[model samples]
Target: MYSEIIRLKELGLNISQIARHLDISRNTVYQYGNLNPDEYNQVLEDMQTRQKKLDHKREKILSWLKEYPDLSGAQVFDWLKERYPEIDISESTVRNYVSYLRKEYDIPKTIHKRDHEAIEDPPQGHQMQVDFGEEKLKNAQGNLVRLWFIAFVLSNSRQKYVEWLDRPFTTEDVIKMHENAFFFYGGRTKEIVYDQDHLILTSENSGDLILTHEFANYTRKRGFLIYMCRKQDPQSKGRIENVVGFVKKNFAKHRTFFNLERLNEDCLAWLERTGNGKKHNTTKKIPAEMFALEKPHLLPVYEKLNSTCKNSITRTVRKDNTIWFMGNRYSVPLGTYDGTEKVVEVMKVQENILVISDLETKQELARHTISLEKGKLVKNNNHGRDRSKGIDKYIETVAVFFNQPSQAKEWLKKIRAQKPRYIRDQLQMLQRSIEDVDVLITEKALNYCLKHNLFSATDFNDAIDYFGKMQPKERITRFGEADFIEIKPLNEMDRSKFETKPMTRDFNYYKEILERGHIC
Candidate 1:
């Protein structure tokens, strides 16, 4: 073919004319015209030499493919480099050589390729993409630990934000991370694109996506639309997908992970100094700089959206008036538990404090500082105490109920001095007894009992019964003319008589009347 193109060119034919005469493409004619006899011989010799360059390694590569047919070209290249470090070859060279060997040796092609199309960037502050990734790294304790991270990238500016977690992200974690990302960017985009992760999307029904309750509530409050990508289509959110891989390769690779806090601190600093600050390959401008221009176009964050993004969990209050939270127990009000399970809402408001509230009313029940150790019992001292039945209040109620303040104080002092351990029980008993008895009767009974230094509830009741029986009864008597003084008009006779002392009744007369059995 080279000779024919050369012969046509020598017959006074231009490049296109030669291509037509030789029945070849113009590119082929030009390529042949550029090569002379000596260069063609040199190229043949170079091809011969290139074929032998991997003559020894070719057997090894074939053997490796026979043993592990699923090995990728990159993996095979890495293996070759490790075994033959002195070999001078580019990855493309190795890849091409491997492909030729696969075809020549009839090695089965095990790798599959998927087609992807490039996506154009959205308008500034119009869209963001979010995704999660995990890596296994050596921790500070020299143990291999798996860490997860969430990545958020603005579609236009390529501004990246990442949050590292030591565990898999739950729905709450996802929302909290989104809040952190939004705050990091100083605003939010109109829409956020996400993968079909369970933390966000629960299901798809009739072409409508069912988002998780937490994420739905979060988007509704934050006033942002969510776009869920199709399953297995990572290229839909290719910006964040590339960012995740970039983070792992550039930031997390070969890095020592001490703790979650320290790791996150270093991650943020890296993002400021390098990740967002450095020039992006696609945008060709620093992400931080582009983000400055994009900020004004972002959606204005409302004040309501600035509310806490803490994770909330529902816990059942145990019979001991305590609820389990983050592997620790925290006390609630005494009546918060009803011997049965009582559901309470708990939120980790801060690193150390958890706010517990009534699930139905959302009324805050207690705030407890979280314990550092697991299985610990963290309690507020006043949580389970009966506020209405304190010792001092009990004494006051008893004193007022019995109309004997001094005696009540004295009785309490005696009980405290004699049986101090039972003082609370005694006071509680007295307070409860007063609820069932009348105030006047209780007062009389208490007075009688206190007179005898008897403080027991049974003694007070007995005294009350005895006093009730010993009380005098009323008798009816018919009035005669002697019992009644003549009712004269005040003007006639009462003016002078009112000034005079009335004649006193004789005791002997009343005694004689009683003795005569006429009193009845």
Candidate 2:
């Protein structure tokens, strides 16, 4: 305090002694050593009420800090600059103001902070790092569309490959992207490094990595080793991490997304020009040129995959549960046939393996080796098996609703024989009609239908309705085992009272309706 300083000075205590007694810095004590109490008090007042450039945005900055306490000064700087571009200021000034706010508000240091150590680059063709990144870009429609990309970078050369998708990545997507990335490099490294991403890993069981099924299969098939970094440890796989950020900031930053195909094509071109063609910031060597020296050391891939080739094609399931592609018929599940032709995705992966899957569920329906000969049927035996099972059980269940179960079953079998493809539909229709009709009327209709050999459900329904609604619910008690319930012919319902006697009118009830304009 200024008063304390003057009191200490009057006591003949030097600046060093005063600083020690007050626990203030010697610099601070010397600066106030010669100033009078009035000047010191004025300085204190100015320090207390000093205005800040970002004071107008204090609330917004505080909320951001409170919500994302781990956000760095640089991130906050970028966010403010992005959202409010008109705000003219330097990053250092924003950082100083942010520090001031943090001290005044008593917020603490962030969590999940980790140490970073520089690592030596792996030898050529020995290692590559892979990771995923996402960004929102303006589409052709000028709407913000979020896109994801899996990035790969060779550790020695910094050669990069990126594949983008409008949707989130899946395990299969990871595999496909890996193939394209390796193909772009002409060969693959012996080992690949990555974060413990869920798409590739199901769990980290202590130290043992359990990969997702598809990714595990793809890894084994490709004969490559994977090293997944520990949780929150980006330092181990920093190459791909930098590549992901570089792709987002450099290539995809302001690029308007037209489509996945166009975006990826542009990305490949960007890599050839700006991404790998220029000198890398750290290595100070062109990545593409380095790749030429490293390519010979890479493990040769079994085949060259053209990234431009479409991954899959949509095929309409035929009525016979077959899809015609490349002049061959491939059978899907039997129930795949529907009133409206259902479509399935057919992906050809690794030679002739046709991976057919449902469009919505993405579950593989069938896998077949494509037939070489045209007009050949590449069928899985299970696919051609009868899809309708337990039909007998369904028939027996329906028969229990009728009084004469045996007769009902026989008639149902006849319907099944007549409509083999639609027996289930027929049985369902028959059961619905039985629910509304009286039992006696149902029996009479069933017997009449059997006698007339009417195997059609529609004809049977007509017979049930035409069985003369003579209080049919009450008519059940009127009929006995010994009594023969006589029913009229199918075409002859008793319409004696219902029928109107034909009266010869001159013309439309004396043309009154026409005069009145009652008929259109």
Candidate 3:
């Protein structure tokens, strides 16, 4: 076309006449007519060797792939972008370059094979799969925000439900999402499939699944069986996995997220219009229509499943008798810490409160009001009372021995108020003096001190000394032979010295004694 325009212009026809003759626009005719043969050839050459932003860093990219063959093109692009900020290149350009280098260098790539067989459709309401996904999107402020979403799909009907979260889902969040998804579908499946998420399964030991305590309780109460996919096995839960990608591509991509509530509202609208309402590619049936058939076969929602969901974490009590939770240290009871290995369960019952319980006994040890500030200590004042147990017992003993319990208690309270730092040593000193001092003297001294409102231990000791010295001394009598009295037995002639007085027993005497209340 350019040659024809140029040739026509060279044949002496005007630009407008040549455009009319060639059935081309006059602008196109003038644009080609202005370019000389040399300039046109130069333009072709420039097109052949166009300099790309990634050309200068080609050697660096190839070297990275040579060193780490498993690294993806996106990873290499990110690395180069961080190191060489001036190099503006798109991710697709880097990927294409990496693909060319791999083929040119004959680098071996690992090929993964699907381990699970193709799945057949289960009975309606028989099975459902759940999975979580994360996406980075531009919010209304144009700042990049990371959002997480949980996807639930019915295997037979292909119906899907999704819930968006601003942060990573905790165990409680996971349970609540499950409840919401079931409610959205109008019922629960007989069995649910998961990808061994840590929120649900803690570990898989030798083919045996160890579920998290909270999720286990949820399953038990909800009356549903749980199936965990094998490790690294995406095909086991492919239905929900596909749904997760579908959401990202069709709903979230290129979408502005102003707020979480509005984003979710838009997502629900999209699902109603496109996601579940449209015919699925695999099933060729509208999910919403199929869901109506599946609804009746689903299990009924039990009231027992409405129990409060809590995030439980096992934390070791530190030597200071405290546990770390949500960026703060909360106190446990005094004896809660047996050692550093003593594990306690911290349950976040609500937003502001945490219940710390002993793992072995399952008894709540302390209730702490969660702190809003980070790195702050939330301590209970009575947690360290065990440290003062000995002093408290000593004060109680002193109070009882002085026979002025209230006075002793008041004096101790004064000491605690004034000399709290030396209270233990002072109590120990008072307890030691009890062994040496007489109880009566101590009681008398205490009475004097109480009357004068003197609470010092020194003052009480001085009073005891003064009162003891003022008391009269007892007389000591020594036994001697002159003070002894001799006694003789009745059989050895002592009977004569003793007067024999015998009273005759009579009914009248007994009656008079009874009447006088002396004898019966």
The number of the candidate with the highest lDDT is: 2
37-73: candidate 3 lDDT, tens digit per residue: 8988887899789986667787888888888878898
Clashing pairs in 1: none
lDDT of each: 0.78, 0.83, 0.80
In model 3, where is the ten-residue run with the lowest total lDDT?
Answer: 475-484
Q: What is the clash count of model 1?
A: 0
lDDT of 2 by residue, 1-520 (tens): 7678778988999989999999999888778878977887899899889988898989999999988877788888999999999999889988887888789898775888566767777888999998989899998888999888999999999999989998666556777788888788999999999897766775677888877555666777788998989999887777788888889899988889888899999999999999999999999999999999999999998784333423565667888899887789999988987867476767888577888888668899999997878999889878866545678889999898788889999999989988999998998998898875566788888899989889988998898878855444344521333232556668876787688787777786768877778654
TM-score of each: 0.41, 0.42, 0.45
Per-model RMSD to reference: 30.5, 17.8, 26.3
For model 3, name the residue pairs that clash. none
Residue 23 in candidate 3, Cα distance off native in Å: 32
In candidate 2 the C-alpha lDDT for residue 50 amounts to 92
TM-score of 1: 0.41
Quick one: ranking by lDDT, best first? 2, 3, 1
